[model samples]
Target: MAIHLVGLALLMGVIISIYLPMITQTAKILGSGPMANIPFFAIALVSSIVIAIASGSRTEQFQKVATLPLWLLTAGVMSAGMIIGSSFLIPRIGIGAFFVLLVSGQVLAGMVFGYFGLFGVPASALTVGKVLGALLVIAGVYLVTFK
Candidate 1:
């Protein structure tokens, strides 16, 4: 569990490092001008795919592990659909409202999953403090962007 957590943290750090500087450099090139920001997003997407493939290949049971998810393709498809849908919806809703709703929903779903031990996870307690912290994060997002 500790190794898995460390791997996840490292993955997140690498992705963020790639994304932040790529977007910043794109902004510099565009000079706050009229060019679209798609290139930076494209670079990030390609980099993420490459990283995923590399990491996936490194597992001891890489081939078998990759094939085991055939039964849950529906869930995977739905997740991808939601990601694409969010890209379309976020601009329409505005960032503040979108983030508030998104993060709150994630925390609610996570709490339920954790408490119930869904998806093979062990049952965990969800205290009032955890819920309050989630709400505080949502409130902070709203305060930052809801001018």
Candidate 2:
């Protein structure tokens, strides 16, 4: 269990620490090229499709997705907006500020989501500790971006 937890942590860390920068740079470069965001995201979509098919989970995943509520289908639309926004914003804001603000927004939204048990997630009360942790994240973001 501990090993699995560590592996998951490492995976997330790599996504944030390494993958995010690479993708952001790719977006920036592609934004400057003649092709622009469409080709970049198209490639990403193709890559994801290939990976999903290769993983042999597509059948089960599609079945599950078919059963999901209509509102859940909007996730793809939201993801497209994030990808497009990131392609445009990262070049202007720089990765540091962009990620900081992105993470801050995610944390804030997570708090609300958890508090209200949104998206069928189990209800988790917003304790004082959670608020303090969020405040610390905000302060950290301010420190990182301003200093």
Q: For candidate 2, what is the lDDT? A: 0.77
- Model 1 clash pairs are none
* Candidate 2 TM-score versus the reference: 0.74
Off by over 4 Å in 2: 1-3, 32-68
**lDDT per residue as tens, model 1, 47-86:** 8768978776645664565677675767755644444444
The residue ranges of model 1 lying beyond 4 angstroms of the native Cα positions read 1-62, 65-71, 134-147
lDDT of 1: 0.62
Residue-pair clashes per prediction, in order, are 0, 0
- Per-candidate Cα RMSD to the true structure, in Å, reads 6.9, 3.2
TM-score of 1: 0.52
The lDDT for every candidate, in the order shown, is 0.62, 0.77
